[model samples]
Target: MKRNNTFFRSVWFIAISGLGGFFLSLTGLSIGWMIGTFLAAALLSFLKPSLLRHDASKKGVPKYWLFIGQCILGIELGQKINLSFLHIFKEYWMTIILMLLLSIFFSLLSGFLLWKYSKTDMLTSFFGTAPGGLSAMPGIAEEVGANTAVVSIIQTMRVFLVILTIPIFVSLWASNPVNHVTLPAQTVSPFEFEKLLWTLVLIGIAYGGYLLGKYLKFPAPWLIGSMVAVAVVQSFGSLFMGHDMVSWWPHVVITLSQIFIAASIGSRFHKSMFIGLKQTLIVAFLSTIGLIFSMIMCAIFVSKVTGIALITAVLAFAPGGIAEMTTTSVVLNADSTFVIAVQVLRIIIVCVILPPFFRLLNYWEHKKHLSSHASA
Candidate 1:
C-alpha cells in the first residue's frame, strides 16, 4: 500500500477517501465518517510536499476541486429552490427590510472596531466582518476595487476560525437546546447509471462554466459558474426530484461534504496562520454573540407582531444565511423561513451599503498613508 506523492496518486487518494467516508456514513457511523475522511486527507498530506505548485495559467488544483465541489453543491441546493415558494413575500418584505437594517449596522460597526484595533486595512475589515457566505465575500471585495488579496486572506481566516470554534462552543454553550441528529446515508446509489450519468453531465457543465469564468477572470469562478448553472437549470424547469424534508442520503452527502470541505479548510490552520488567534478569539466571540443577540431581539419583536413563539422568531431573526441558519432551524424545528428572510435581507443591505463604506475606508487609508509620507 505504498502511496506516491504524484497528482494522480492524489486523485486516487481523494476518491478512496470520499468512498470511505461515504460508506462509513451510510452505515450510520456519523462521527467516524467525518473523522475518517479528514484523517485520510491529513495522512496523505504527510506524503505531499508542503506546497503542490501548479501553474495558474495551466489550471490549478483549487480550480478543479472547487468546480467539482460547487457542482455537487449546486445539485443539492437547486433541488430546494422553486418558483412556488415566492408567494409568501406579499407583506413580509417590510419586516425583512427591518431585520436587514439592524444586521447591517451591527455587523459593520463590529467590523469597524476590529479593523481599527487589529490594524488591518478596511477591505480586510469588511470581509472579516461579513456574517454570510465565506466563499462569497472575496469576489465582492475584488469587484468593488477594494483590497482583494488582503480581504481574501481575512475572509478565509475568519471562516476557518468560525468553522473550528463555533461548533465546539455551541456544543458547550447550548448543551441541550435540541438533540443533534446524525445525518443519513445516500439511498440513491452514486453508482446508479441514471444518477451517475446526471452527475457527470452536471459536473461537465459545472467545470465548463468554471473554465469560462476563469478565462473571463470572474473573481470567484466556482461560485459564478455554479450559481449560473443552478439558476439557468431551475429557470428552464430542469429540477431534480425534490427531497423537501431532507432524507438520510442527502443528509449523508451534506454531512460528508461538510467534513471534506471543513477538513480541506481546516488543514490551513497551521501554527503559522494563527499569529493572533488568541487575541482574535475575543473579537470572534463578541462579534458572533452580538450579531446573534441582535437577531434574537428582531425575532422577538417579529414574534410579538406575528404571534409565533419567541424561539421560532429568534431563530428566524438570526442573520445567518439560508444554508447554515435554515438547516439549523429545521433541525431544531424552528422557523426556517423567518431565518431565511432575515439573512437574505441582511445580505442585500451589505451588498448595497458595503461598496460605499469600502470606498470611504480605502480613501481614508490612502489619505492617512499620504499624510504620514508627507510628514516623513
Candidate 2:
C-alpha cells in the first residue's frame, strides 16, 4: 500500500510538471517546456513543508527516464554529424581551438570569483562554473569530493539564465528577424523491414557504446558514447547507401525527454542546499553574468576573425549545455552543426583537463597545511 501511494504521488507530480511545461510552451519561450516544468517542480520542492502537507512524499522522476532522454538527445546530435560538418571544422580549426581555450579561461575565472567571494570550496566552485552538461557536472563534483547540492543548484541556475537570455538577445541584436526552421521530414526507406533493421542496429550500437564507455570511465559516458556510436554507424551507412541517415527522433519524443530531464533536475533541490542561500545565489548570478559577457565578447572576436555569423559564433560560445544550446540554434536557425561540435569539444576538454588540475591543487593545499602544522 505504501509503495502504491508513492507511485501515485510520483505520477501526480510528473503530470503537474508536464502541465506546467505545456502552459509555458504556449508563451513562446525558448525551451519553454523544460523551463516551465523545472520551475514547477522546483517550487513544489521548495514549498513542500510550508504550504504543502508535511507528509507529502517526495519522489524524483525515474533515473532511467533521464537516461532515455540522454540517449534520444545523443542520437539527435549524432544525426547532425556529416562530412560537410567535418569540412567546416577543418576550415575553421584554428578559430575553433581559440574559442575553446577562451571558454575554458572564462570558466576558470568565474570559478575563481565564486571561490574568492562565496567561500565555496575550489572543486565545487569550479565544477559549478565549468559550463558542462547539467546532468554530468554534479556527479563529477561528488566524485571530486565537492558539495553536490551546491554544484547542482549553481549549474542549474546558470543554465536557466543562459537559456532564458541568449535567444532574446540574439533576436534583438541580429539585423534580420529571427526565423524558425522547421526540421525536414524524415526520409523513410521504401522497404519497411530495412527501416526497422536500421533502427534496431542504431539502438544496438548506442547500447554497446554506452557499455564500453562505462567500462572505460569516460565522462558523461552514456551521452558521449551513444552520440559517437550513432554518428559512426550513420556515417558508414550513408557511405554505403549514398544518402544521409534519417533521424528517428520526433518532436513529441524530444519534448517528453526534455520534461523528464527537467523534472529530474528540479527534484534534486533541497531546503538544506539553501542554508547559505543568499550569498550563494548572488555569487552564482554574478559569476554566470560574467561568464556570459565574456563569451559574448569572445563570440564577437571570433565572428570578426573567422567571418562566421555573429549569432552562430555566439551560440557556439554560449556556456550552456549541449542539448539546450543546440535546440536554441535549431530554433533560431543558426549554425546548429557548428554549435553542437564546439559544445561537445568543450565538454570533452573540460572533463579531461579539469580533474587532474584540481587534484594538483588539492595536493598543494594539503602539503601547505601539513607544513604549517609541522611548524606549529
Candidate 3:
C-alpha cells in the first residue's frame, strides 16, 4: 500500500480516534485510552474504508503520529527510571537474561506450532509469534519476504490479548510488595516556568536520542532511543549537576501519547487484512493464550529465584508492549522501572538476534518447498 501523505485528509479520522480514546478513558481501565483509540480507528477503517483510505492501494493515517506518540511514551517511561534501577539491573541482570531467553524460547515454540497447524506460511507464523515490539515485527517481516499483512494482523492480535488479559491477571493474583522502588518527591507545579524549561530540554533530548538510535539502527528507535536518552539524563542529572531534574510531568501528556499510539495502530487494521486468515487467526489466538500462560509460569519461577515481587516479575516477563506493561505497573503500584528495563532488554534481544534467525528459517523453508515441487 502507498503511504497516506496528506495530513489534512486524516484530520477527521484523528478526531474520531481521540473521541474514541476519551470515551474509553471513562471506563477507568488503566490502558483504556489506548485500547479505545485502537478500537475506534480499527472500526472506522473496517466500517468506512473510504474515509481513511484503508485499502490495498493506500495506507491509513500518517506514520508521524505514531512516532510522536512513541516519543512521548519513551519520555514518560524514561522519567520513571530512578537511580534504584541501577541497583535492580545490577542485582538481577543474570536472572533477567535467563527469563528473557525462556520467554523467547516459548514464543518461538508457539510460532512453530502455528506454522505446523495453521495454513499460514513459516515466515508469517514465526514473525507473528515473536514478542518483539508490535511496530517492529511487521516491517522486519516484510523485508524478509514474509506476509506483512498476516504478520501485522497476528502481532496486533497477540498484543491485544496480552494487554487485555495479563495485566488483569497480575493485578488480581500477584500481591503488591511494600518494598516498591520509590522516586524522589518533587514539589513543582506542572505550569512552573522552571519545570516547563526542563520539559522542553527533555523533549529536545528525546529528539536527539531518536536520531542517534536511528543511526545505530535500533528497533523502534523513536521509542527506545528517546527512552534511553531521557532515562540517563533524568537518572544521573543530580550526580553531574548537583540538582535533581524535574520529577513531575503532567498525566495529560501521557494520555495524549496513548491516544496517538492507539489511533495509529487501529487505523492500520482493515477487513482486507483478515479476509482469508480465519484458520490462521484461530491458531494464532490459541497459541497466544498458551504463550501467555507459559510466560506467567516462567515469571513465577523468576519471582521465586530472584525474590522479586510476583507482579513485578509477571509484568517484566509478560509478552506485551513496553508502554502498556509499564503503565499497568505504575497503576498497580508495582516496580515500573524494573518492568521497563526488562521490556527494553527483551526488545533489544529480539531485534538483534531473531530477524537473522527467522531469515535463515525462511531460506530453508523456501529451499524445501522448491525441492518438493521439483520432485512433484
Candidate 4:
C-alpha cells in the first residue's frame, strides 16, 4: 500500500512536469520541453514541503527516469550517425582538437577566478566549473569530498544557461549563414516487421551496452554505451545486412525523453541547497557567463578557420550536454554528429584530466594549511 501511494504521487508530479513541458512546447522553442520541465520540477521541488501533503511527494523523481531518458536520447542520436562523420573528422581533426583544448582552458580559467573570489573551496569551484556533464561532475565531486551541493547547483546553472542561450543564438545566426554543411536527416520508414526486428535488436543492444559500460566504469554509461552501441550497428548496417536499418521514431518520444531528463535534473534542486551560498551563487553565475563568452569567441575563430557555420561551431564548442546540443543541432539543421563527437570528447577529457589535477590541488592546499597551523 505504501509503495502504491508513492508510485501514484510520483506519477502526479511527472504529470505536472509534462504539462509544463507541453505548454512550453507550444511556444515553438527548439528545446522548450526540457526548459519548461526543468523550471516546473525545480519550482515544485522547492515548494514541496508547503505544497505537498505527503513525504513521498517531496522526494525527487527517480533516477531511473533519467536513465531511461538518456537511453532513448542515445538511440535517437545514434540513428543520425553515418559514414560521412568519418570524412568530417578526418578533414578537420586538428581544428576539433584545438577547439576542445581551448574550451577546457577557458573553463579552468573561470574555475580559477571563482576559486579566488568566491567562498567556495578550490576543489568545488573547479569541479563545478569544469564543463563536465551535469550528471558526471556532482558524483565525481562527492568522491573527493568536495561540496556536492555547490557542484550540483553550479553545474545545473551552467547547463541551464547554455541550453537557454545557445539555441536562441544559434537559431538567429543560422538565419543568414552561408557555406555551412548541414548533415542529412535520418531515413524514416513506415512501421513493419523488418523495422520491428531492427528496433528490438537496437533496444537489446542499448541495454546490453549500458550494462557493459557500467562494468567498464564509463561516465554517463547509459548514454555513452547506448549511443556507441547503436551508432556502430547503424554505421555498419550495410556491411552486415546490405541496407540501412529502418527507423520509425515518433517526435513525441524525443520530447518525453527531454522532460524525463530535465525533470530529474530540476528535482535535484531544493531550497536548502542555497541556504547560505548567496555570494558563491553570484560568483558562479558570473564565472559561468565568462566561460560561455570565452567559448563563443573560440567558436567564432574556429568557424572562420574551419569553414563550419558559426552556429554549428558554437554548438560544437559550447559547454553543454551532448544530448541537448545535438538535439538543437538536429532542429536547426546543423552538423549534429560533430556536436556529439566534440561534446563526448570534452567530457572524456575533463573526466580524465581535471579530477586528478583537482586532487593534487586539494592535497597541496591541505599541506599548506597544515604548515601554516604549525607555524602559528
Query: Please, what is the TM-score per model?
Result: 0.62, 0.78, 0.76, 0.74
Task: Look at candidate 2 and tell me the lDDT of residue 349.
Answer: 66
Which parts of model 3 have CA positions greater than 4 angstroms off? 1-5, 53-57, 121-123, 132-189, 216-220, 231-244, 321-337, 347-376
How many residue pairs clash (N, CA or C atoms closer than 3 angstroms) in each of the candidate models, in the order given?
4, 0, 0, 0
Candidate 4 positional error at 333, Å:
7.8
Evaluated at residue 213, the lDDT of candidate 2 is 68
Superpose all Cα atoms of candidate 3 onto the true structure and report the RMSD in Å to 1 decimal. Answer: 5.2
TM-score order of candidates, best first?
Answer: 2, 3, 4, 1
Question: Candidate 3's C-alpha lDDT?
Answer: 0.77
Error of 4 at 313 (Å): 2.9
Residue lDDT tens for model 4, 207-239: 887898778866566776787787778778844
Write model 2 residue lDDT over 223-271, tens digit each, in one string. 6668778777877777677776664444676677667766655565566
lDDT values for all models: 0.51, 0.72, 0.77, 0.76
Candidate 4: which stretches are off by over 4 Å? 49-59, 121-127, 132-190, 236-246, 307-312, 320-376
Candidate 4 overall lDDT versus native: 0.76
RMSD of 1: 7.1
lDDT of 2 at 6: 54
Scored by lDDT, the top model is 3
What TM-score would candidate 3 get against the native?
A: 0.76
